[model samples]
Target: MLKSFDNKALEELNDSNASENERAKKGLKKRSDFGYAVLFLGPSLLLLGVFVFYPMIKTLYMSLFLTNNFGQTTIFVGLKNYTSLLTSASFLASLSSTFIYVIGVMVLTIVLGLALAVFANQKLKGIQFFRTIFSSTMGVSVSVAAIFFLFVFNPTTGLLNQMAGLLHLPQLNWMTDPNLAMITVIVSTVWMNLGFTFLVLFGALQAVPRSLYDAADIEGASKSYQLFKITIPMISPSLFFVGIVTLIGAFKSFGLIDLMTAGGPNNATNLLVYRIYQDAFLNGNYSQASTESIVLTIIIAVMTIIQFKVLEKRVNY
Candidate 1:
Protein backbone atom coordinates (compact mmCIF):
# COMPACT_ATOMS: atom_id res chain seq x y z
CA MET A 1 0.00 0.00 0.00
CA LEU A 2 2.90 2.47 0.91
CA LYS A 3 4.64 1.78 -2.42
CA SER A 4 1.39 2.48 -4.26
CA PHE A 5 0.92 5.79 -2.38
CA ASP A 6 4.56 6.85 -3.15
CA ASN A 7 4.04 6.13 -6.87
CA LYS A 8 0.82 8.20 -6.85
CA ALA A 9 2.66 11.21 -5.26
CA LEU A 10 5.48 11.00 -7.85
CA GLU A 11 2.83 11.11 -10.61
CA GLU A 12 1.32 14.33 -9.10
CA LEU A 13 4.81 15.91 -8.90
CA ASN A 14 5.45 15.08 -12.56
CA ASP A 15 2.17 16.78 -13.55
CA SER A 16 3.17 19.98 -11.65
CA ASN A 17 6.62 19.94 -13.28
CA ALA A 18 5.00 19.73 -16.72
CA SER A 19 2.80 22.77 -15.93
CA GLU A 20 5.88 24.74 -14.73
CA ASN A 21 7.73 23.89 -17.97
CA GLU A 22 4.81 25.28 -20.03
CA ARG A 23 4.81 28.51 -17.95
CA ALA A 24 8.59 28.84 -18.42
CA LYS A 25 8.14 28.59 -22.20
CA LYS A 26 5.58 31.38 -22.10
CA GLY A 27 7.93 33.53 -20.05
CA LEU A 28 10.74 32.93 -22.57
CA LYS A 29 8.49 34.21 -25.36
CA LYS A 30 7.62 37.30 -23.30
CA ARG A 31 11.33 37.95 -22.70
CA SER A 32 11.98 37.70 -26.47
CA ASP A 33 9.26 40.32 -27.05
CA PHE A 34 10.92 42.56 -24.44
CA GLY A 35 14.29 42.13 -26.19
CA TYR A 36 12.72 43.33 -29.44
CA ALA A 37 11.28 46.31 -27.60
CA VAL A 38 14.74 47.15 -26.28
CA LEU A 39 16.15 46.81 -29.77
CA PHE A 40 13.74 49.51 -30.94
CA LEU A 41 15.04 51.81 -28.19
CA GLY A 42 18.72 51.14 -29.02
CA PRO A 43 19.22 54.17 -31.22
CA SER A 44 17.95 56.65 -28.64
CA LEU A 45 20.03 55.01 -25.92
CA LEU A 46 23.15 55.14 -28.11
CA LEU A 47 22.63 58.81 -28.93
CA LEU A 48 22.14 59.75 -25.29
CA GLY A 49 25.23 57.84 -24.19
CA VAL A 50 27.39 59.35 -26.89
CA PHE A 51 26.21 62.95 -26.58
CA VAL A 52 25.65 63.12 -22.83
CA PHE A 53 27.75 60.56 -20.95
CA TYR A 54 30.79 60.61 -23.25
CA PRO A 55 31.12 64.39 -23.15
CA MET A 56 30.59 64.40 -19.38
CA ILE A 57 33.41 61.90 -18.87
CA LYS A 58 35.67 63.79 -21.28
CA THR A 59 35.00 67.06 -19.38
CA LEU A 60 35.88 65.36 -16.10
CA TYR A 61 39.11 64.05 -17.57
CA MET A 62 39.95 67.43 -19.02
CA SER A 63 39.62 68.98 -15.56
CA LEU A 64 42.59 67.04 -14.21
CA PHE A 65 45.30 68.13 -16.68
CA LEU A 66 47.01 71.29 -17.90
CA THR A 67 46.65 72.05 -21.59
CA ASN A 68 49.03 74.51 -23.28
CA ASN A 69 49.47 75.89 -26.83
CA PHE A 70 51.92 73.11 -27.84
CA GLY A 71 49.59 70.15 -27.44
CA GLN A 72 47.36 68.41 -24.86
CA THR A 73 49.48 67.18 -21.98
CA THR A 74 48.08 65.29 -18.99
CA ILE A 75 50.17 66.34 -16.04
CA PHE A 76 47.85 64.87 -13.37
CA VAL A 77 48.17 68.00 -11.22
CA GLY A 78 45.99 66.38 -8.54
CA LEU A 79 43.96 68.97 -6.52
CA LYS A 80 45.85 72.06 -7.70
CA ASN A 81 42.98 73.33 -9.79
CA TYR A 82 40.52 72.94 -6.94
CA THR A 83 42.93 74.56 -4.50
CA SER A 84 43.49 77.53 -6.74
CA LEU A 85 39.76 77.91 -7.31
CA LEU A 86 39.07 77.87 -3.58
CA THR A 87 41.86 80.27 -2.65
CA SER A 88 41.36 82.82 -5.40
CA ALA A 89 39.79 86.12 -4.22
CA SER A 90 37.90 86.53 -7.49
CA PHE A 91 36.37 83.09 -7.14
CA LEU A 92 35.29 83.84 -3.58
CA ALA A 93 33.75 87.14 -4.66
CA SER A 94 31.88 85.41 -7.47
CA LEU A 95 30.71 82.75 -5.03
CA SER A 96 29.12 85.39 -2.84
CA SER A 97 27.52 87.08 -5.83
CA THR A 98 26.06 83.74 -6.93
CA PHE A 99 24.63 83.13 -3.49
CA ILE A 100 23.02 86.56 -3.45
CA TYR A 101 21.63 86.12 -6.95
CA VAL A 102 20.18 82.72 -6.10
CA ILE A 103 18.48 83.97 -2.97
CA GLY A 104 17.13 87.12 -4.61
CA VAL A 105 15.66 85.30 -7.59
CA MET A 106 14.13 82.51 -5.53
CA VAL A 107 12.47 84.88 -3.10
CA LEU A 108 11.15 87.28 -5.71
CA THR A 109 9.90 84.57 -8.05
CA ILE A 110 8.04 82.63 -5.37
CA VAL A 111 6.48 85.73 -3.85
CA LEU A 112 5.38 87.15 -7.18
CA GLY A 113 4.22 83.74 -8.43
CA LEU A 114 2.15 83.04 -5.36
CA ALA A 115 0.54 86.46 -5.52
CA LEU A 116 -0.21 86.18 -9.22
CA ALA A 117 -1.61 82.68 -8.88
CA VAL A 118 -3.85 83.69 -6.02
CA PHE A 119 -5.06 86.69 -8.00
CA ALA A 120 -5.66 84.66 -11.12
CA ASN A 121 -7.54 82.01 -9.18
CA GLN A 122 -10.07 84.61 -8.10
CA LYS A 123 -13.41 84.84 -9.92
CA LEU A 124 -12.66 88.05 -11.73
CA LYS A 125 -13.91 89.20 -15.14
CA GLY A 126 -11.44 88.77 -18.01
CA ILE A 127 -9.31 86.52 -15.84
CA GLN A 128 -8.05 84.63 -18.85
CA PHE A 129 -6.77 87.82 -20.42
CA PHE A 130 -4.96 88.78 -17.24
CA ARG A 131 -3.37 85.36 -17.01
CA THR A 132 -2.27 85.47 -20.62
CA ILE A 133 -0.65 88.87 -20.13
CA PHE A 134 1.13 87.69 -16.98
CA SER A 135 2.29 84.40 -18.51
CA SER A 136 3.35 85.89 -21.84
CA THR A 137 6.82 86.55 -20.50
CA MET A 138 7.52 82.82 -20.33
CA GLY A 139 7.57 82.55 -24.11
CA VAL A 140 10.11 85.38 -24.44
CA SER A 141 13.66 84.11 -24.86
CA VAL A 142 16.16 85.06 -22.16
CA SER A 143 18.37 86.89 -24.65
CA VAL A 144 15.44 88.88 -25.98
CA ALA A 145 14.24 89.79 -22.50
CA ALA A 146 17.74 90.89 -21.53
CA ILE A 147 18.00 93.14 -24.54
CA PHE A 148 14.51 94.48 -24.01
CA PHE A 149 15.28 95.40 -20.41
CA LEU A 150 18.63 96.83 -21.46
CA PHE A 151 16.85 99.32 -23.70
CA VAL A 152 13.98 99.96 -21.30
CA PHE A 153 16.35 100.80 -18.44
CA ASN A 154 18.87 102.85 -20.40
CA PRO A 155 19.87 105.86 -18.25
CA THR A 156 19.56 108.43 -21.05
CA THR A 157 16.55 107.59 -23.19
CA GLY A 158 14.99 104.54 -21.48
CA LEU A 159 11.32 104.33 -20.55
CA LEU A 160 12.03 103.90 -16.83
CA ASN A 161 14.34 106.91 -16.60
CA GLN A 162 11.89 109.06 -18.56
CA MET A 163 9.09 108.04 -16.25
CA ALA A 164 11.23 108.80 -13.21
CA GLY A 165 12.09 112.18 -14.67
CA LEU A 166 8.39 112.93 -15.16
CA LEU A 167 7.80 112.03 -11.50
CA HIS A 168 10.68 114.35 -10.46
CA LEU A 169 12.58 111.32 -9.07
CA PRO A 170 16.31 110.92 -9.42
CA GLN A 171 17.44 109.08 -12.54
CA LEU A 172 19.03 105.79 -11.50
CA ASN A 173 21.62 103.84 -13.44
CA TRP A 174 19.73 100.54 -13.68
CA MET A 175 22.35 98.39 -15.42
CA THR A 176 25.68 100.17 -15.13
CA ASP A 177 25.94 100.39 -11.38
CA PRO A 178 27.23 97.24 -9.64
CA ASN A 179 24.54 97.12 -6.97
CA LEU A 180 21.73 98.00 -9.36
CA ALA A 181 23.01 95.73 -12.15
CA MET A 182 22.60 92.61 -10.01
CA ILE A 183 19.18 93.80 -8.88
CA THR A 184 18.09 94.36 -12.48
CA VAL A 185 19.18 90.86 -13.43
CA ILE A 186 17.37 89.38 -10.44
CA VAL A 187 14.17 91.24 -11.25
CA SER A 188 14.31 90.26 -14.93
CA THR A 189 14.86 86.61 -14.06
CA VAL A 190 11.98 86.68 -11.59
CA TRP A 191 9.63 88.16 -14.19
CA MET A 192 10.67 85.68 -16.86
CA ASN A 193 10.29 82.65 -14.56
CA LEU A 194 7.21 83.77 -12.63
CA GLY A 195 4.82 82.56 -15.32
CA PHE A 196 5.69 78.89 -15.02
CA THR A 197 5.62 79.02 -11.25
CA PHE A 198 2.28 80.78 -11.33
CA LEU A 199 0.82 78.17 -13.67
CA VAL A 200 2.11 75.34 -11.49
CA LEU A 201 0.75 76.81 -8.27
CA PHE A 202 -2.53 77.79 -9.87
CA GLY A 203 -3.06 74.25 -11.12
CA ALA A 204 -2.22 72.86 -7.71
CA LEU A 205 -4.69 75.25 -6.13
CA GLN A 206 -7.45 74.23 -8.56
CA ALA A 207 -6.78 70.55 -7.86
CA VAL A 208 -7.55 70.86 -4.12
CA PRO A 209 -10.83 69.14 -3.28
CA ARG A 210 -13.78 71.50 -2.89
CA SER A 211 -15.24 69.26 -0.23
CA LEU A 212 -12.50 70.32 2.17
CA TYR A 213 -13.40 73.99 1.76
CA ASP A 214 -17.09 73.18 2.28
CA ALA A 215 -16.23 71.23 5.40
CA ALA A 216 -14.12 74.12 6.66
CA ASP A 217 -17.00 76.51 6.11
CA ILE A 218 -19.36 74.19 7.93
CA GLU A 219 -16.91 74.09 10.82
CA GLY A 220 -17.01 77.91 11.06
CA ALA A 221 -13.42 78.26 9.79
CA SER A 222 -12.68 81.65 8.21
CA LYS A 223 -11.37 81.89 4.67
CA SER A 224 -7.96 83.02 5.87
CA TYR A 225 -7.80 80.19 8.38
CA GLN A 226 -8.83 77.64 5.79
CA LEU A 227 -6.22 78.98 3.40
CA PHE A 228 -3.44 78.63 5.92
CA LYS A 229 -4.60 75.25 7.24
CA ILE A 230 -5.89 73.60 4.11
CA THR A 231 -4.93 75.36 0.89
CA ILE A 232 -1.28 75.95 1.72
CA PRO A 233 -0.68 72.39 2.88
CA MET A 234 -2.46 71.00 -0.17
CA ILE A 235 -0.33 73.21 -2.40
CA SER A 236 2.96 72.53 -0.57
CA PRO A 237 4.13 69.97 -3.09
CA SER A 238 3.78 72.41 -5.97
CA LEU A 239 5.54 75.18 -4.05
CA PHE A 240 8.37 72.80 -3.22
CA PHE A 241 8.75 71.88 -6.88
CA VAL A 242 8.72 75.51 -7.99
CA GLY A 243 11.23 76.42 -5.34
CA ILE A 244 13.73 73.83 -6.53
CA VAL A 245 13.32 74.75 -10.19
CA THR A 246 13.74 78.44 -9.40
CA LEU A 247 16.83 77.75 -7.32
CA ILE A 248 18.47 75.73 -10.08
CA GLY A 249 17.59 78.28 -12.73
CA ALA A 250 19.00 81.08 -10.63
CA PHE A 251 22.26 79.16 -10.17
CA LYS A 252 22.62 78.36 -13.86
CA SER A 253 21.70 81.86 -15.07
CA PHE A 254 24.16 83.00 -17.69
CA GLY A 255 22.25 84.63 -20.52
CA LEU A 256 20.88 87.69 -18.70
CA ILE A 257 24.21 88.35 -16.98
CA ASP A 258 26.09 87.84 -20.22
CA LEU A 259 23.85 90.15 -22.23
CA MET A 260 23.22 92.80 -19.59
CA THR A 261 26.16 93.17 -17.22
CA ALA A 262 28.68 90.73 -18.63
CA GLY A 263 29.46 90.13 -14.94
CA GLY A 264 30.69 93.70 -14.90
CA PRO A 265 31.31 96.50 -12.32
CA ASN A 266 34.52 94.89 -11.06
CA ASN A 267 33.09 91.34 -10.91
CA ALA A 268 30.35 92.44 -8.52
CA THR A 269 27.73 90.69 -10.67
CA ASN A 270 29.93 87.77 -11.71
CA LEU A 271 28.20 84.47 -10.97
CA LEU A 272 29.88 81.09 -10.87
CA VAL A 273 28.37 79.98 -14.18
CA TYR A 274 29.42 83.22 -15.91
CA ARG A 275 32.86 82.82 -14.38
CA ILE A 276 33.01 79.27 -15.75
CA TYR A 277 32.18 80.56 -19.23
CA GLN A 278 34.81 83.28 -18.98
CA ASP A 279 37.41 80.80 -17.77
CA ALA A 280 36.69 78.14 -20.36
CA PHE A 281 36.21 80.19 -23.54
CA LEU A 282 37.63 83.68 -22.94
CA ASN A 283 40.66 82.79 -20.83
CA GLY A 284 41.23 79.24 -22.15
CA ASN A 285 41.73 77.93 -18.59
CA TYR A 286 39.97 74.69 -19.27
CA SER A 287 41.25 72.90 -16.19
CA GLN A 288 40.19 75.70 -13.87
CA ALA A 289 36.83 75.94 -15.57
CA SER A 290 36.32 72.19 -15.18
CA THR A 291 37.15 72.46 -11.51
CA GLU A 292 34.58 75.24 -11.10
CA SER A 293 32.05 73.19 -13.05
CA ILE A 294 32.54 70.18 -10.79
CA VAL A 295 32.23 72.33 -7.68
CA LEU A 296 29.03 73.92 -8.96
CA THR A 297 27.64 70.48 -9.85
CA ILE A 298 28.34 69.25 -6.33
CA ILE A 299 26.68 72.31 -4.81
CA ILE A 300 23.56 71.82 -6.91
CA ALA A 301 23.45 68.10 -6.08
CA VAL A 302 23.70 68.84 -2.38
CA MET A 303 20.89 71.41 -2.55
CA THR A 304 18.71 68.91 -4.41
CA ILE A 305 19.38 66.24 -1.83
CA ILE A 306 18.58 68.66 0.95
CA GLN A 307 15.35 69.66 -0.71
CA PHE A 308 14.24 66.05 -0.92
CA LYS A 309 15.29 65.12 2.58
CA VAL A 310 14.14 68.24 4.44
CA LEU A 311 11.67 70.41 2.53
CA GLU A 312 9.88 67.53 0.80
CA LYS A 313 9.12 65.93 4.13
CA ARG A 314 6.90 68.88 5.09
CA VAL A 315 4.77 68.50 1.96
CA ASN A 316 1.30 67.10 2.74
CA TYR A 317 1.31 64.77 -0.25
Candidate 2:
Protein backbone atom coordinates (compact mmCIF):
# COMPACT_ATOMS: atom_id res chain seq x y z
CA MET A 1 0.00 0.00 0.00
CA LEU A 2 2.87 2.35 0.90
CA LYS A 3 4.62 1.58 -2.37
CA SER A 4 1.41 2.27 -4.37
CA PHE A 5 0.98 5.68 -2.69
CA ASP A 6 4.59 6.59 -3.45
CA ASN A 7 4.13 5.66 -7.14
CA LYS A 8 0.88 7.70 -7.36
CA ALA A 9 2.55 10.73 -5.78
CA LEU A 10 5.54 10.46 -8.16
CA GLU A 11 3.25 10.25 -11.17
CA GLU A 12 1.23 13.29 -10.03
CA LEU A 13 4.38 15.30 -9.44
CA ASN A 14 5.73 14.38 -12.89
CA ASP A 15 2.45 15.35 -14.54
CA SER A 16 2.49 18.69 -12.75
CA ASN A 17 6.09 19.35 -13.84
CA ALA A 18 5.23 18.50 -17.47
CA SER A 19 2.30 20.92 -17.49
CA GLU A 20 4.48 23.64 -16.01
CA ASN A 21 7.13 23.08 -18.71
CA GLU A 22 4.48 23.35 -21.45
CA ARG A 23 3.18 26.60 -19.97
CA ALA A 24 6.71 27.96 -19.72
CA LYS A 25 7.30 27.21 -23.41
CA LYS A 26 4.01 28.91 -24.35
CA GLY A 27 4.90 31.96 -22.27
CA LEU A 28 8.31 32.28 -23.94
CA LYS A 29 6.75 31.96 -27.39
CA LYS A 30 4.22 34.68 -26.59
CA ARG A 31 6.96 37.03 -25.44
CA SER A 32 9.02 36.32 -28.54
CA ASP A 33 5.99 37.03 -30.78
CA PHE A 34 5.33 40.27 -28.95
CA GLY A 35 8.96 41.34 -29.39
CA TYR A 36 8.76 40.62 -33.13
CA ALA A 37 5.50 42.54 -33.44
CA VAL A 38 6.99 45.55 -31.68
CA LEU A 39 10.03 45.40 -33.93
CA PHE A 40 7.88 45.28 -37.06
CA LEU A 41 5.35 47.95 -35.99
CA GLY A 42 7.68 50.39 -34.20
CA PRO A 43 8.61 52.44 -37.26
CA SER A 44 5.02 52.90 -38.43
CA LEU A 45 3.85 53.79 -34.90
CA LEU A 46 6.67 56.33 -34.52
CA LEU A 47 5.89 57.91 -37.86
CA LEU A 48 2.16 58.16 -37.10
CA GLY A 49 2.85 59.65 -33.67
CA VAL A 50 5.20 62.31 -35.04
CA PHE A 51 3.34 63.21 -38.21
CA VAL A 52 -0.37 62.60 -37.60
CA PHE A 53 -1.16 62.39 -33.89
CA TYR A 54 1.23 65.11 -32.80
CA PRO A 55 -0.11 67.57 -35.37
CA MET A 56 -3.70 66.76 -34.40
CA ILE A 57 -2.88 67.27 -30.73
CA LYS A 58 -1.05 70.50 -31.50
CA THR A 59 -3.97 71.83 -33.55
CA LEU A 60 -6.44 71.12 -30.72
CA TYR A 61 -4.09 72.71 -28.23
CA MET A 62 -3.67 75.76 -30.43
CA SER A 63 -7.43 76.15 -30.79
CA LEU A 64 -7.78 77.09 -27.12
CA PHE A 65 -5.61 80.20 -27.29
CA LEU A 66 -5.40 83.41 -29.33
CA THR A 67 -2.69 83.28 -31.93
CA ASN A 68 -0.88 86.10 -33.76
CA ASN A 69 -0.16 86.37 -37.48
CA PHE A 70 2.62 83.81 -37.13
CA GLY A 71 0.19 81.30 -35.56
CA GLN A 72 1.95 81.74 -32.23
CA THR A 73 -0.66 81.40 -29.48
CA THR A 74 -0.47 84.30 -26.97
CA ILE A 75 -3.64 84.65 -24.91
CA PHE A 76 -5.52 81.88 -23.12
CA VAL A 77 -8.94 82.37 -24.58
CA GLY A 78 -11.17 79.47 -23.52
CA LEU A 79 -13.77 78.58 -26.19
CA LYS A 80 -14.09 82.20 -27.38
CA ASN A 81 -13.01 81.21 -30.86
CA TYR A 82 -15.53 78.41 -30.95
CA THR A 83 -18.43 80.58 -29.80
CA SER A 84 -17.55 83.38 -32.20
CA LEU A 85 -17.20 81.05 -35.18
CA LEU A 86 -20.37 79.17 -34.32
CA THR A 87 -22.26 82.44 -34.56
CA SER A 88 -20.46 83.93 -37.58
CA ALA A 89 -22.40 84.25 -40.83
CA SER A 90 -19.39 83.30 -42.97
CA PHE A 91 -18.89 80.17 -40.97
CA LEU A 92 -22.56 79.26 -41.26
CA ALA A 93 -22.56 79.77 -45.02
CA SER A 94 -19.40 77.75 -45.41
CA LEU A 95 -20.83 74.96 -43.28
CA SER A 96 -23.98 74.80 -45.39
CA SER A 97 -21.99 74.79 -48.63
CA THR A 98 -19.67 72.16 -47.27
CA PHE A 99 -22.59 69.82 -46.58
CA ILE A 100 -23.97 70.44 -50.05
CA TYR A 101 -20.66 69.79 -51.70
CA VAL A 102 -20.01 66.64 -49.68
CA ILE A 103 -23.47 65.18 -50.33
CA GLY A 104 -23.35 66.08 -54.00
CA VAL A 105 -19.96 64.51 -54.47
CA MET A 106 -20.81 61.41 -52.46
CA VAL A 107 -24.09 60.67 -54.25
CA LEU A 108 -23.01 61.51 -57.79
CA THR A 109 -19.69 59.75 -57.51
CA ILE A 110 -21.24 56.48 -56.33
CA VAL A 111 -24.03 56.48 -58.92
CA LEU A 112 -21.85 57.46 -61.89
CA GLY A 113 -19.07 55.17 -60.80
CA LEU A 114 -21.42 52.22 -60.53
CA ALA A 115 -22.88 53.03 -63.94
CA LEU A 116 -19.42 53.18 -65.47
CA ALA A 117 -18.39 50.01 -63.70
CA VAL A 118 -21.41 48.20 -65.13
CA PHE A 119 -20.65 49.51 -68.60
CA ALA A 120 -17.05 48.39 -68.34
CA ASN A 121 -18.09 44.99 -67.00
CA GLN A 122 -19.87 44.09 -70.21
CA LYS A 123 -18.12 41.40 -72.32
CA LEU A 124 -18.48 43.31 -75.58
CA LYS A 125 -15.57 43.71 -77.97
CA GLY A 126 -13.25 46.70 -77.22
CA ILE A 127 -14.49 46.60 -73.62
CA GLN A 128 -10.88 46.63 -72.37
CA PHE A 129 -10.34 49.99 -74.06
CA PHE A 130 -13.38 51.42 -72.34
CA ARG A 131 -12.23 50.02 -69.01
CA THR A 132 -8.84 51.67 -69.45
CA ILE A 133 -10.46 55.02 -70.19
CA PHE A 134 -12.83 54.62 -67.25
CA SER A 135 -9.96 54.07 -64.82
CA SER A 136 -7.48 56.48 -66.41
CA THR A 137 -8.63 59.41 -64.26
CA MET A 138 -7.42 57.55 -61.17
CA GLY A 139 -3.85 58.26 -62.23
CA VAL A 140 -4.47 61.99 -62.68
CA SER A 141 -3.26 64.06 -59.75
CA VAL A 142 -5.38 66.78 -58.11
CA SER A 143 -3.10 69.55 -59.49
CA VAL A 144 -3.38 68.19 -63.01
CA ALA A 145 -7.16 67.78 -62.78
CA ALA A 146 -7.60 71.27 -61.38
CA ILE A 147 -5.44 72.89 -64.07
CA PHE A 148 -7.24 71.00 -66.83
CA PHE A 149 -10.65 71.93 -65.49
CA LEU A 150 -9.60 75.60 -65.23
CA PHE A 151 -9.40 76.05 -68.99
CA VAL A 152 -12.37 73.77 -69.54
CA PHE A 153 -14.55 75.93 -67.29
CA ASN A 154 -13.23 79.30 -68.49
CA PRO A 155 -15.97 81.58 -69.89
CA THR A 156 -14.35 82.33 -73.26
CA THR A 157 -12.36 79.30 -74.39
CA GLY A 158 -14.26 76.78 -72.30
CA LEU A 159 -15.65 73.78 -74.15
CA LEU A 160 -19.14 74.32 -72.75
CA ASN A 161 -19.27 78.01 -73.75
CA GLN A 162 -17.82 77.22 -77.15
CA MET A 163 -20.48 74.60 -77.63
CA ALA A 164 -23.11 77.05 -76.48
CA GLY A 165 -21.81 79.66 -78.95
CA LEU A 166 -21.83 77.12 -81.74
CA LEU A 167 -25.43 76.24 -80.89
CA HIS A 168 -26.34 79.97 -80.75
CA LEU A 169 -27.45 79.57 -77.13
CA PRO A 170 -27.07 82.12 -74.35
CA GLN A 171 -23.50 82.59 -73.16
CA LEU A 172 -23.15 81.72 -69.48
CA ASN A 173 -20.31 82.01 -66.98
CA TRP A 174 -18.98 78.75 -65.57
CA MET A 175 -16.53 79.62 -62.78
CA THR A 176 -16.88 83.35 -62.21
CA ASP A 177 -20.64 83.22 -61.61
CA PRO A 178 -21.52 82.39 -58.01
CA ASN A 179 -24.53 80.26 -59.01
CA LEU A 180 -22.52 77.94 -61.25
CA ALA A 181 -19.21 77.83 -59.38
CA MET A 182 -20.23 75.21 -56.79
CA ILE A 183 -21.85 73.07 -59.46
CA THR A 184 -18.73 73.26 -61.63
CA VAL A 185 -16.58 72.32 -58.65
CA ILE A 186 -18.84 69.43 -57.81
CA VAL A 187 -18.78 68.17 -61.37
CA SER A 188 -15.01 68.38 -61.55
CA THR A 189 -14.57 66.76 -58.16
CA VAL A 190 -16.89 63.93 -59.19
CA TRP A 191 -14.92 63.42 -62.39
CA MET A 192 -11.65 63.36 -60.47
CA ASN A 193 -12.91 60.80 -57.91
CA LEU A 194 -15.04 58.68 -60.24
CA GLY A 195 -12.18 56.52 -61.40
CA PHE A 196 -11.36 55.25 -57.91
CA THR A 197 -15.01 54.50 -57.15
CA PHE A 198 -15.38 52.76 -60.53
CA LEU A 199 -12.32 50.62 -59.90
CA VAL A 200 -13.55 49.46 -56.50
CA LEU A 201 -17.08 48.66 -57.66
CA PHE A 202 -15.77 47.01 -60.82
CA GLY A 203 -13.50 44.78 -58.79
CA ALA A 204 -16.38 43.93 -56.50
CA LEU A 205 -18.62 43.15 -59.47
CA GLN A 206 -16.01 40.84 -60.88
CA ALA A 207 -15.76 38.94 -57.60
CA VAL A 208 -19.51 38.24 -57.62
CA PRO A 209 -20.16 34.77 -58.94
CA ARG A 210 -21.97 34.62 -62.26
CA SER A 211 -23.97 31.69 -60.97
CA LEU A 212 -26.36 33.98 -59.15
CA TYR A 213 -27.23 35.82 -62.35
CA ASP A 214 -27.52 32.53 -64.21
CA ALA A 215 -29.98 31.22 -61.65
CA ALA A 216 -32.00 34.40 -61.83
CA ASP A 217 -32.08 34.24 -65.61
CA ILE A 218 -33.34 30.64 -65.56
CA GLU A 219 -36.19 31.86 -63.33
CA GLY A 220 -37.25 34.37 -66.04
CA ALA A 221 -36.02 37.42 -64.07
CA SER A 222 -35.54 40.62 -66.08
CA LYS A 223 -32.19 42.34 -66.43
CA SER A 224 -33.24 45.26 -64.23
CA TYR A 225 -34.57 42.86 -61.63
CA GLN A 226 -31.31 40.95 -61.68
CA LEU A 227 -29.38 44.17 -61.32
CA PHE A 228 -31.34 45.43 -58.36
CA LYS A 229 -31.87 42.16 -56.56
CA ILE A 230 -28.79 40.19 -57.53
CA THR A 231 -25.93 42.49 -58.41
CA ILE A 232 -26.53 45.17 -55.73
CA PRO A 233 -26.79 42.82 -52.78
CA MET A 234 -23.60 41.04 -53.78
CA ILE A 235 -21.68 44.31 -54.07
CA SER A 236 -23.35 46.15 -51.21
CA PRO A 237 -20.26 45.95 -49.00
CA SER A 238 -18.08 47.59 -51.63
CA LEU A 239 -20.71 50.26 -52.19
CA PHE A 240 -20.79 51.00 -48.47
CA PHE A 241 -17.00 51.32 -48.37
CA VAL A 242 -16.89 53.59 -51.43
CA GLY A 243 -19.63 55.80 -49.99
CA ILE A 244 -17.70 56.46 -46.78
CA VAL A 245 -14.43 56.99 -48.65
CA THR A 246 -15.93 59.47 -51.11
CA LEU A 247 -17.77 61.27 -48.31
CA ILE A 248 -14.54 61.81 -46.41
CA GLY A 249 -12.66 62.77 -49.58
CA ALA A 250 -15.33 65.32 -50.43
CA PHE A 251 -15.13 66.87 -46.96
CA LYS A 252 -11.35 67.19 -47.15
CA SER A 253 -11.28 68.67 -50.67
CA PHE A 254 -8.95 71.68 -50.70
CA GLY A 255 -6.38 71.73 -53.51
CA LEU A 256 -8.88 71.57 -56.38
CA ILE A 257 -11.19 74.12 -54.76
CA ASP A 258 -8.26 76.41 -54.05
CA LEU A 259 -6.99 76.17 -57.61
CA MET A 260 -10.34 76.54 -59.31
CA THR A 261 -12.59 78.88 -57.35
CA ALA A 262 -10.57 80.39 -54.50
CA GLY A 263 -14.05 80.52 -52.90
CA GLY A 264 -14.90 83.29 -55.34
CA PRO A 265 -18.01 85.19 -56.50
CA ASN A 266 -19.37 86.24 -53.06
CA ASN A 267 -18.35 83.20 -51.02
CA ALA A 268 -20.69 80.88 -52.88
CA THR A 269 -18.15 78.13 -53.27
CA ASN A 270 -16.62 78.66 -49.85
CA LEU A 271 -16.47 75.14 -48.46
CA LEU A 272 -15.48 74.65 -44.82
CA VAL A 273 -12.13 73.15 -45.75
CA TYR A 274 -11.27 76.10 -48.00
CA ARG A 275 -12.63 78.44 -45.33
CA ILE A 276 -10.05 77.00 -42.93
CA TYR A 277 -7.29 77.80 -45.41
CA GLN A 278 -8.67 81.32 -45.98
CA ASP A 279 -8.83 81.97 -42.25
CA ALA A 280 -5.30 80.83 -41.53
CA PHE A 281 -3.41 82.09 -44.57
CA LEU A 282 -5.57 84.75 -46.27
CA ASN A 283 -7.28 86.34 -43.28
CA GLY A 284 -4.55 85.53 -40.71
CA ASN A 285 -6.97 84.15 -38.11
CA TYR A 286 -4.91 81.17 -37.00
CA SER A 287 -6.62 80.39 -33.70
CA GLN A 288 -10.07 80.42 -35.25
CA ALA A 289 -8.79 78.30 -38.08
CA SER A 290 -7.54 75.77 -35.56
CA THR A 291 -10.97 75.79 -33.92
CA GLU A 292 -12.60 75.32 -37.31
CA SER A 293 -10.31 72.42 -37.99
CA ILE A 294 -11.41 70.77 -34.75
CA VAL A 295 -15.05 71.34 -35.60
CA LEU A 296 -14.55 69.88 -39.06
CA THR A 297 -12.86 66.84 -37.56
CA ILE A 298 -15.76 66.29 -35.17
CA ILE A 299 -18.31 66.67 -37.95
CA ILE A 300 -16.47 64.15 -40.08
CA ALA A 301 -16.26 61.72 -37.17
CA VAL A 302 -19.97 61.98 -36.45
CA MET A 303 -20.86 61.58 -40.10
CA THR A 304 -18.62 58.55 -40.38
CA ILE A 305 -20.18 57.00 -37.31
CA ILE A 306 -23.66 57.62 -38.72
CA GLN A 307 -22.71 56.03 -42.02
CA PHE A 308 -21.26 52.98 -40.32
CA LYS A 309 -24.30 52.55 -38.14
CA VAL A 310 -26.86 53.08 -40.88
CA LEU A 311 -25.23 51.76 -44.05
CA GLU A 312 -23.46 48.82 -42.50
CA LYS A 313 -26.77 47.10 -41.82
CA ARG A 314 -27.38 46.80 -45.57
CA VAL A 315 -23.91 45.46 -46.29
CA ASN A 316 -24.12 41.81 -47.40
CA TYR A 317 -20.97 40.78 -45.61
What ranges in model 1 sit over 4 Å off?
Answer: 1-29, 33-38, 69-71, 214-224, 306-314
User: What lDDT score is found at residue 246 in candidate 1?
Assistant: 88
Residue range 1-317, candidate 2, lDDT tens digits: 01123334555688998887898988754245678889999999999999989989999989999999999989999888889989999899999998999999999999999999988888899999999899989999999999888878889998888989999998789987887999999999999998888999999899989888889889999999988998888899778778887888888899888899988878988998899999999989999999999998998778676565555354554
Local error of candidate 2 at residue 98 (angstroms): 0.7
Counted clashes in each candidate structure: 0, 0
Candidate 2, which segments miss by more than 4 Å at Cα?
1-28, 32-39, 304-314
Local distance difference test values of all predictions, in order: 0.82, 0.86
What does candidate 1's lDDT look like per residue over 1-317, in tens digits?
01123334556689988887898988754244667778999889899999978867766776777766332545888777788889999999999999999999998998889888877877788999988877788799998998888888888999999999999999999877889888888988998898788888888888989889889999999978987898778888778778877898789899998998999977889999999999888987788888888888888877666565544255555
Q: Estimate each model's TM-score.
A: 0.84, 0.86
Error of 1 at 18 (Å): 25
Model 2 deviation from native, Cα RMSD in Å = 12.0
| lDDT agreement of model 2 with the native | 0.86
lDDT of 1: 0.82
